[model samples]
Target: MMKRAEQKGVVENEAPQTSQKSKKQKTCSYGSVFGECDLHSSVDWGNLPHHVILRVFQFLPLVDRARASSVCRKWNEVFHIPDLWRRFEFELSQPATSYLKSTHPDLIQQIIKRHADHLQYVSFKVDSSTESAEAACNILSQLVNCSIKTLGLISTAKPSFMNVSKAHFASALTVVFVNSKSLSSIKIDDTPLDDPSLKVLVANNSDTLKLLKMSSCPHVSPAGILCVADQCHGLKELALNYYILSDELLLALSSEKHVDLEHLRIDVVSENPGQVEFHTIKKQSWDALVKHSPKVNIVMYFFLYEEEFDAFFREETPVTHLYFGRTVSKAMLGRIGMNCPRLIELVVCANGLQPLDDELIRIAERCKNLTAMGLGECEVTCRGFIEFVKMCGGRLTQLSIMEEVLIPDNDYSLDRLHLEVSKHLGRLWFPDMMPTW
Candidate 1:
């Protein structure tokens, strides 16, 4: 009986070894090269369809795609596909300052050599370093044969492109501007993009340019922006600083030859608070623009002191979106409620100790189109805020109120404020709680 038991144990161990061998063989069968791949095999990984491989490559980052291409000969071919290179963003950075991974120089060279013509939508993301900006400019200088359509030069932190030589930057940028005849969208904010370069850009891509966002560009004057408005009649969206906005530019855009504007963003930044006096647009010019492009959404951003707001919202402004980035007064808010009838969105970052109950009620009474609102370091009684929500009801798509902004009153407590606001908003709502840590 002991001998029988020993034989049974040996059989059990041998059975597991045979099963392990079968699994190993099955794994190896799918791991072979494409040349040895069999379509009839139960599972043939190397023989996946070309489109399938391309789809897989699309989801991978550039570096990982390069590594994955070396897995097999077929994958390497897919890596070089023109479709994969159509839209590429070159990330240029230095290790000392930026945490972003810089694109490998060799890969960039390879792309410029092999896939420059295939590029259509391209962007350069650089850190706050002159060296990285120089590298990006160098790459742009080499893309002489490319036909990029949409181009964006984004600074990860501060505007580092300002450190680059203006001549070098303009020359390199002119290469793409001159070559790409069908360029449509360009965003070159916070760069030393002067009026001369702006002329080159409009001279080349005037007919095809549709959207241009060039804000925080001190070098570009009102004449440069006016030139763009006059020449690029196909422009649908425009964004620039308030200093560059002129009544003549608005009149030029309002001409019959120009297409109806869709969106306009004006940044009212106060670098020198008391010294900077902003010019107001004539009401006739605004009326003409409204008559020409009645549906245009005018967005205004105010990053100025309380006194600096006197020039704005006094007249019947057509501003649809208004944002107050500094300490705004109750009088300013009251002015917005009275003048801005087309207001759709409002965000107030800071308000003094005065509560905005009357201003909120007036806005709810007048601005029928108000859909979104956000209040930060401001005071509003929980009862008043609830009343405002109730008056705006279901139409208020976005209501963002800070927890501290809403003071608990007799009718409303901290616990019940959200429940009341949610009922009127037709969605579950909660005040943004400040993080303890």
Candidate 2:
């Protein structure tokens, strides 16, 4: 009986070993060079429709896009497709010593050589370093057959970008401007673009140009901007500094040849340190602009010294979106309410000890289309805030007032405020609470 039981146990162990050996044989049938692989059984994402796959790839960042190209043989072919390479952005990092991943010049050259002809939209955004800017312009100069539709140059580092020479930047950019036949929109902030480059840009793409945003471009004079305004009749959007804006430029934009302009953005930055001086665009000019393009949105952004506010709202200004970078006074808020009748959005950084009771009420009364607002380190009574919300109604889509913005008055009540505001806002609303940090 013992011998018979031992024979049965041996049979059971042998059966399990045979099954394990067969599993290994099945896995090894794939014929991997080093080891077995399940290549035949894996999902084949490459079989997705070509257009659908390209659309999916469009949402990936440049780094991820490059990584995905190495996934498979079919994917490698799809990665080099011209359509997929049309719109590209170079997020060039700082130098290697600074511990940032800088773009390689050889990679830029390879792209220019291989895919320049297929390029339609391109932007060069560099960190605070001269080498990256050099690489950007170098890449630009080598775009031999490129016919990009939209070109944008941006600098993440504030002061270092100013270091690149205007001549070198312009020379390389002119190569692109002159080459492309159907350039439409451009954004070249903090670059040293001059009048000659403007002339070249307008000469080549006057008819096709629609949007131009060149803020902080000190080298380009009012005439340079005016030239663009006069020539580019199809231009719908423009952004420039205060110094570049003038009566002539406004009229040029509002001319009969030009279509009803859509948006005009002005950066009201103080040119000098501790300097309160500012150049004003007369109310008459603004009126003429409104007359020509009745629905034009005049957006003004103020980054100024406290004293510079005087020159801003002397008379009624047609400002739609207003932002005050410095501490704004109740006086300025009062002027904003009276003068900025067309204000659609207002962000006040600060108002002194006295509550902005009348100012807030007056703003709510005047600016009917006030959709979004933000208050930081400001003083306002709870009653005034409630009234403003009620008047503005649900149209106040994005009301971002900070916690300390509400001054403790007799009417201050967090629960009551929340209840009243939520009823009008169409959602639960409360003042932005102070951060623990």
Candidate 3:
């Protein structure tokens, strides 16, 4: 009788345990069916290591990361970790806008107050309004403990950075230059940035600076840029205007103390398109740069009026990527053959009703490394076009000719031309295609 009583007690204990287990399984299933639990909350995700979870979360956007934090308490902690905030881009749009959703004002304040120190790579892209620039400056001045490694100040509008007063932009930027002593990259284009602030930056972070891009800065003179090149021995990539590109600057960059430069970009922007006097850079200066850094890529972007293009492409240049914004003439295209022998990409925006047969043949014969060609509002004969394609052959990766560029003939009709070109390019060809914007 005592043995029977003991067996009954054991059965009673096992019964309740199994019942509880069943109840828990039912609850999990119900929740899964009702969408109350996501994949991350499921049993499979719970088994993942914490490091893997953190790595997955790191790749998510900031807004998506915020949503992910709600999955669990552990994820919430990982979302707020300082390491996750190292690389960040703050899209500071106004409260209500058409293009992009505005970042909340309260969240911006919170990030500045609590997480400013965690930002290592940060970029502030502002809208057209001056208010956004002011807000950026205000936050910049307040980052007393920031140790930013890379920082970019970008303006969506062309003239918006100038809308901010020079003094204000300079003073606020000085704070960041003074604090972030280990900055490696800085891109501040279109700002009314002057020399004194540059001096402050070079004095503090010149040793660590590597890549600097200020393509459209009008306030900085050649002397200011020279100072940067002299001090920043580790600079690898630089972009500037034709005005600052002098023999002395190239020599400064060629110093034995400096590392081998990798890329140099020149923005040929015109302030007044109607001006008669066109600025030019000597070929000898470019030759010296080539001697020092043979493998370096030289890229040039032109934003000129039709009148301003007369002085360009006078002699041999090391332009790998060339853009012509204005309507180009046959003479200019002809000179391009002689000057840009090492050309890789050519984009001509507009060309008059003249046939570009000779120019096209000249480019194909001379520019052996040319891989892409684009023509807009230009003319090319059918036979000339076939020979040009045969010359470019399989090497031409991109041949964007507007439908109007090819003058159809009985021998080389549009359909026949496309069929022949497609056989060469290994892709569907259409001469009527528009130039990629």
The top-ranked prediction according to lDDT is 1
Scored by lDDT, model 3 comes in at: 0.77
Error of 2 at 47 (Å): 8.0
2 against 3, candidate with superior TM-score? 2
Regions of candidate 3 where Cα sits further than 4 Å from its true position: 1-53, 67-73, 96-98, 424-428, 434-437
Residue-wise C-alpha lDDT for candidate 2, range 121-207, written one tens digit per residue:
998888778877877887888886888999998787765456778888888988899999789999998888899999999999999
- Residue 378's lDDT within candidate 2 is 80
In order, candidate lDDTs are: 0.85, 0.77, 0.77
Model 3 worst lDDT window (10 residues) = 8-17
Question: What would the TM-scores of all predictions be?
Answer: 0.89, 0.85, 0.85
The better-scoring model by TM-score among 1 and 3 is: 1
Question: Candidate 1 on 133-214: residue-level lDDT in tens?
Answer: 9999999999989899999999988859998899999999999999988889999999988999889999999999999999
Worst 10 residues of 2 by lDDT: 8-17
Task: Give the Å shift of residue 407 in candidate 2.
Answer: 1.5
What are the RMSDs of all candidates, in order? Answer: 10.6, 11.7, 10.6
Residue 155 shift from truth in candidate 2, angstroms: 1.4
lDDT of 3 by residue, 38-123 (tens): 33454444335677768877776655555444444455556667888888787766655426455555556656776889989988
Instruction: Give per-residue lDDT, candidate 3, residue 218.
Output: 84
